[model samples]
Target chain A: MSTAIRDDYLEKLIESWKKEASPVHSVSYLDQLREDALDRIESLRLPTIRDEEWRFTDISSLRSMPFPRASAAPLPGLDKQAGTFLDETACRLVFVDGQYMSGLSSLADDGSITVCSLSELIGTRASIAERYFGQLADFQENVFVALNTALMHDGVCIVIPAGVSVKVPVHILYVTSRKDVAVYPRCLLIAEPGANVTVVEEYVTLYEGASLTNAVTEMYIRDSACVNHIRVQRESSQAFHIANGSVLVAQSAHYDSVSLALGARISRFDQKIILAGGNAECEVDGLALIAGRQLADTHTFIDHANPHCRSRQLHKCIVDESAHGVFSGKIMVRPHAQQTDARQLNRNLLLSDKARMDTKPQLEIFADDVKCAHGATVGQLDNESLFYLRSRGLTEVAARNLLTYAFGGEVINRVIVPSLKQRLEEYILARTRIG
Target chain B: MINANSKVLLEVRDLHATVGGAEILKGVNLTVRSGEIHAIMGLNGSGKSTFAKVLAGHPSYEVTQGTVLFDGQDLSVLAPEERAQAGLFLAFQYPVEIPGVANDQFLRLAYNTVQGHRGKEELDPLEFDDFVREKMKLLKMNPDFLDRSVNEGFSGGEKKRNEILQMALLEPRLALLDETDSGLDIDALRIVANGVNQLSSKDNAMILVTHYQRLLDYIVPDYVHVMEAGRIIRTSGKELALALETHGYDWIHANDQATGAQP
Candidate 1:
């Protein structure tokens, strides 16, 4: 819709990217869908800062390089690190370089849920995939999702039957070990009527290398169903990560998500939630801790299409050492969507003089009887608070680190998985810990 | 219980300080000996609180002309934390709120730091919990306060009690109680005054900065000095506080006018 994305440089880059051969696949069931995505990719060009949606995020550096696909390889030193596995998880799915590693994964079938790779799931669950796959996440509006759909390898799929509730969370760990390569990660989750489940999707790196990760995730919750999604991306500083998440909530269904971005040279996460049925609800929260020339951007859009929908969101960022953080959250209440309650808040802490934060809260309300509120703030540490800590015998560095750590603790505490929460706490501490 | 080897803990010589290009504490002098408590009574904006903050090395206040020595060492050479580690404490008039940092953790760190500086053993979490709880009893604070964020959502009296609780834990050589009696009910005042009285000993001293003479009834000071216009206009025993309470401050201005001095 914007002319900025159609510039000559990006158009040439898009043409070159399209010329590259598609990823090899054996799943012939979705050949036509993949073909349709590839054709759509040809018409869409890369976005630049001049575009209204990407004014603060500059991705011209990505157009300068050609990141080819990589084949399956043994993960380097993953046996020692376990690739950040979480405790008390019902099932664990491991993907290395966009290829599913069955040897490193564990599956348990209790007859109430189904979790498997897309390839192996094609036989008996073909109907489930055919019905929900590529349904909610439209590729026409998003270039990253279209690219991911056109070149994705194997993906993880989880289906919860009706009238059943899953207690433990499902863990999906994506590991990046190859440098100078592009990896496409996909996830499809479907909660049937009255089903309930929790999922943790984490992207980590086994080595520090330059890479690109394009991720697309879709979640569908039917009537009275509930789902909790926790997505963590702590990739290497040399990596560029772009992810898109699309969610749909039915009548009386609930969806909650927590997205954390800790490490990435440049990262952008776009999340869209649609309350399609009456009385649907969602709680979306996020945190981004970055430093040393890193840039992290988050864009969220919540649509209240039906009456009696509620959306609550809080996004925070701790920027240090010349790092830049950006957040733009938009909530839309349609003309007929009465009784809609929406709230958004964005708070940022800039630790260094050069650290920067760009925050904006957009509310588009067409219904006169709806309720909506939004606020944003950016500031440094309070001098009085710092002196108060110092007066009590704490060093200045220790005081600063403690305050910075506490700023992020509010979002990290929302994680339900114990081991994962502990890991995240440790991660934040290590980042803010004084030498 | 006085530490006889180093009796005189603080000596402020003609202290002149300015904040935001305006002088607050001008030409003030005082000496505090171990085992002695002094009360500085003054009206609002008379620089009593500024004097305490200056001694505690607050970054905002600048000592334009002054010499402060603590135990024969120049106080200007130490940073705020270093001064704190050197056994100097200042209870803030308005306790700062530090959200998300638990009171127990902050108290233990402050205790262990000063203890380490004094060559004492550091306590673990369990040990610190027991030790802090015993000290919290001095102020009659609830055990739930230990888990709350420091001064966050605390009532005015609770904040004042937390300050005194910290004083009991640190056991500083010289404690500057800056308006600690403000914003406290009579019951909270008695509890805070009793806690301060218990924390004081012959080995340590205190300088109570207050506006009213009501607090003097609970903690009887050895000396009381009336401050006016950034300087101590009169120095006398505790009777002077009662005299000021009864006679009011009008006679001081009359005396200042008679002596040809600024009121």
Candidate 2:
């Protein structure tokens, strides 16, 4: 009887999502990709706690909710919402409810890079889209990625030309303003050989009711190219956010990313990075600050496929009230990848007796001459350290919050963007505030 | 700075304390007055450090039976921060290293908190920086030390010096120095001693917990007390520290058998 109800729910969800496709002149390649995604989604079902990877994260709440796709409607007072923008950078792309808003975004006209909304440049950049779109992030078995690929309305496309250095950072802002709505946001970035650029991906919401945001991002760095990706998610606590990011690092290329999960009722971030050539390096740092029944789950896979590669990862969580935080990081050094150095650490702070954290760091090194070290620690405030602070005239509550703020600050300080860094720091302080 | 008629600041009567259900302080009694410096000399298990921790209200140490009066107010009921706010300071033997908090920021916060409690005007960052720099000179600390995390990667002597540096900033009325001279070299000892001596005034009292008389050579104490088996069995002038250095603790254990018994 239970299986019958579950099967019926799956059929209903898929039927509702099929209509989310663009109702305009569709390109043949993208239509074929969408057909493939739809076929994959039909074979998969919503994950339960019984699955090994989903054991600690129970997304059953999302499976049973309404999956209504957002309709394109002009948002009132959008100009007044400019406060959500970062520093004055002309190179920004805006997407509201999975649809690109051309009037709300500005782009640098220097011609050093190509930034476009796939909806606007579908005719001219179809070749670029055909080469990389729906490629890095495999949707073979992942339902969320498959759904995003099948339903993405307007996707972000960035191309840094060869040997060009794009000094102006590009910002891709994803906004959700409707309740009971599911928004699928997509992005693809390709840095040519010896080219460099920075991209900021932000997910925010003006909706206070149950909402869903499924985002997919794919990045490719060519030989000697460098890319910095900073992803920030600060949605309403009543929203559910799931994101998948795939990156490929070429010979001697560098990838640096810092992702922060500060708000959400239930959020999961899945990232996979592949170092395809020798001497490729990547630094992936993440921080999740959740409280009051919120749950944040992060899973990362780094594959050192070539020789002489290095990967560094540090993920931290500050759990307060009855919130839960989960981290699972896997670093793999292929059999032939020698001289690969990898370090991964996950540290958690439990502020309340009911707060929970499940952290796992897995390192699989097949090379004989490789160095890989991983560690995870979950603890409350130190009694000795607390006493030391209280002895210095700080109240017990003040001392505890300070220590908690400092724990999350380690990752926040790594953000070189001054305004964003300060914003994250203040968010940590406010969340850890003691009454 | 000693005056026989100085006002009493801290008075402990029949104190008893246990750590992890093991009694470490038994029936210890002491009286401290303003304008005086007292040196406590003892062996490892003599409970001198435990007494200092209990006075500072360490959480691990439970006062099974005791009554402590700080400036004639019952000190047992107050919290550790309350004690600190009421002009009490303990220089930990092993100072803790706080990683993310800058040394200058921690010191300034502590100073301002204590100053606010005392109803004194608080100084801004510029003024406090100028003032603290002058105080750091007494301990021969570099200005860059303020920029680093509190005591993180500091040498043993540097940690001890930081303890004294805090002493100068807080200006507690009753200070307890718990083995502050243990990790110091000769040069560091001189600098620390000079700093403590300069912080001492006619309205403040300090008790130095040490195991050797060498510290007494630099910071001359007005009185010296010998603790044996959780009790102060002997109290005399500063000359007693010299006698204990030469005679060792063995002979004094035999003389204090009367008061050394566990209560």
Candidate 3:
């Protein structure tokens, strides 16, 4: 066992790294990278209640508890529970304790796409792995991100060749099977030029007790390519989850991502989409259902760096009991990014007096000739609408449930995949029951 | 069949209501006995709709000074839901579309709420399905309608018929039909009128509010009240409706002014 890691511990670690001799096998650049990460972790500070981004979500409870690093051990009793979350045709990649379990995974025999553990790729295909391993994500600036990047053991790597399209979705199931254990799971997806693919990433916890999952996903879409990404987070109520997704869109490419947040005691999702090429399009849609004393925060940034790019975002949230939900979406169009059309909308429904939701949709356009707009609304179910339903013979509870379901359903229904949409609908209905 | 001596169902004493700082109904009085249909005909802004809304406890309308007694209980003291559970139904002119609630679920909940208020046990979903099916048959509505979202994509005629179906399920002591004939075609009007006629009973009352006498032609009222401004100036039997139809509301207003009577 080791002493708990804190800010002082990070600082001490950085100080020791500056004086200690370099390891014998690793290259100079890799050693410097590790040292740089350690220095950044020492300098970067954790967000507190005073920070606006951390207003609704408090990490004090997490900081007080002792978190043990997840061991590279085989997980038992997961096969019984994993079958329900994965579809039949999905190329399932399973990971336990932040280590890929090849024996537990099932891949398509056809091999339209290459799927392997990040550690294996880093060892065998060092050049291809080195080019994108940690370029898109800036862990040094964020504490949880830095911690994950520092301790990440193994991850999932997916690559689709040029002009190739995979019909079946690739599934990455990351599960935490132990209590008081901390797992850092990473995933990197690279789609070559003119490639089309769909990826589904899910995060779940098998145990109901306390745990922590710090995960990051980086996706790179090349020229004229299309990628559909879906993320479903269903952690236990006693779990703390911090997830970050970074996407880079190339020339004339299209990127679509949908996130469903229905779990975790305290969850923070940070996503960024960079339009790096001309005539590119990006769409991000998300929904969150928070109940009990849970807190969920979703922050997104859409950076329009090129011309003739368009982006659309809509995030809906339903909060019940003493739950709190936060949404902060910012769309930025650079000065050279002319002819940009971007829109963002955030709507929230509060179901109880103790429940609260804070939404801020912001647009910062430096280009004079761009069309950008953002709007946010936080309100309860319309009284007139409720009475209207009740007058139609609905009970008060039934009327409220119907309206809430509809409010959340509007976003869920927009999912293009019929099977995924049906699953989401059933999940939402089940949550609405307790609400 | 509605019996003649079923007793009074609704009693209004100088009911006055205002909306947004403007007085709509000014000291208007009316009474409706069970088994009798009363017609309230008025031009636009004459407070006819306000009268219906006030009876249903709409929050927008403020009752300045008045008492509405429904089946021996004070209506003003009840919330909108409480008033609804008390057997008082108001068919809105523009029915609100609740996009997510199923039509059948809404109907069953409303029926059970009213039943619970009347000290009766609520029916289970199976029993309620049977109950609503019978009422749907009476309104000539398809069974598929029960599965659709409440009025989300319903036609104007369908919305009105759905309202009538709800009235049939609740079996209210008093039904206030507010502009129920608007946006309805001849066939829809006939069907709606027929449904209302079938739901009427000696132990229940009805007040039909409309601009035209066309609805009165189908659902004949025992009494007619012609309103001007915020007051009912003339009260007559079924024949006065014919007179008003033949001469228009202007003629009645002129006659009232000539006689120096307040409208």
Candidate 2 falls in which docking quality class? medium
lDDT of 3 by residue, B1-263 (tens): 24567787788998888999899999888888888899999899888988888888777789999888888889888877777777889998888887666788767777777888789888999999998898888778888999898888999989999999988888888889998999999998988899999887777889999998999989999889987778887888888888888898888868877998765
Looking at candidate 1 chain A, the ten consecutive residues that score lowest on lDDT are: A1-10
Comparing 2 with 3 on TM-score, the higher-scoring candidate is 2
* B25 Cα displacement, candidate 2 (Å): 0.5
- Looking at model 2, residue A311 earns an lDDT score of 97
Per-residue CA lDDT of model 3 for A1-435, tens digit only, reads 133335764544334433534332343333445555655676676688888877767787776544666765786656776234455445879988788888778887787888888666545455666777677887767877776666565688888889899888888889888788788898989999999988888888888988989898999999999999988888999899998899999999999988989899999999999999999999899989999998989999999999999999989899999999999998999999999999999989999999989887888889999888888888998988877765544556766877888888767766666667777777876776623
Better of 2 and 3 by lDDT: 2
Q: lDDT per residue, candidate 1, B69-167, as tens digits?
A: 998899888888888999999999999988767789889988987888889999999999999999888888999999998999999999999999999
Model 1 ranges with Cα > 4 A deviation: A1-25, A76-79, B1-6, B255-263
TM-scores for candidates 1 onward, in order: 0.94, 0.94, 0.82
Q: Clash number for every model?
A: 0, 0, 3
Give residue A384's lDDT in candidate 1 (0 to 100). Answer: 81
What local distance difference test score does each model get?
0.88, 0.88, 0.82
Instruction: Give residue B54's error in model 1 in angstroms.
Output: 1.5
**Tens digit per residue, CA lDDT, model 2, B1-263:** 67879899999999999999999988988999999899998999899999998998889999989789999999889889899999999999989888777799889988988899999988898999998999999889998999898899999899999999998999999999999999788999999999999998999999999999999998899989989889898888998898888878776665456557532
Candidate 3 Cα lDDT to native? 0.82
Q: What value does DockQ give for candidate 3?
A: 0.34
lDDT of 2: 0.88
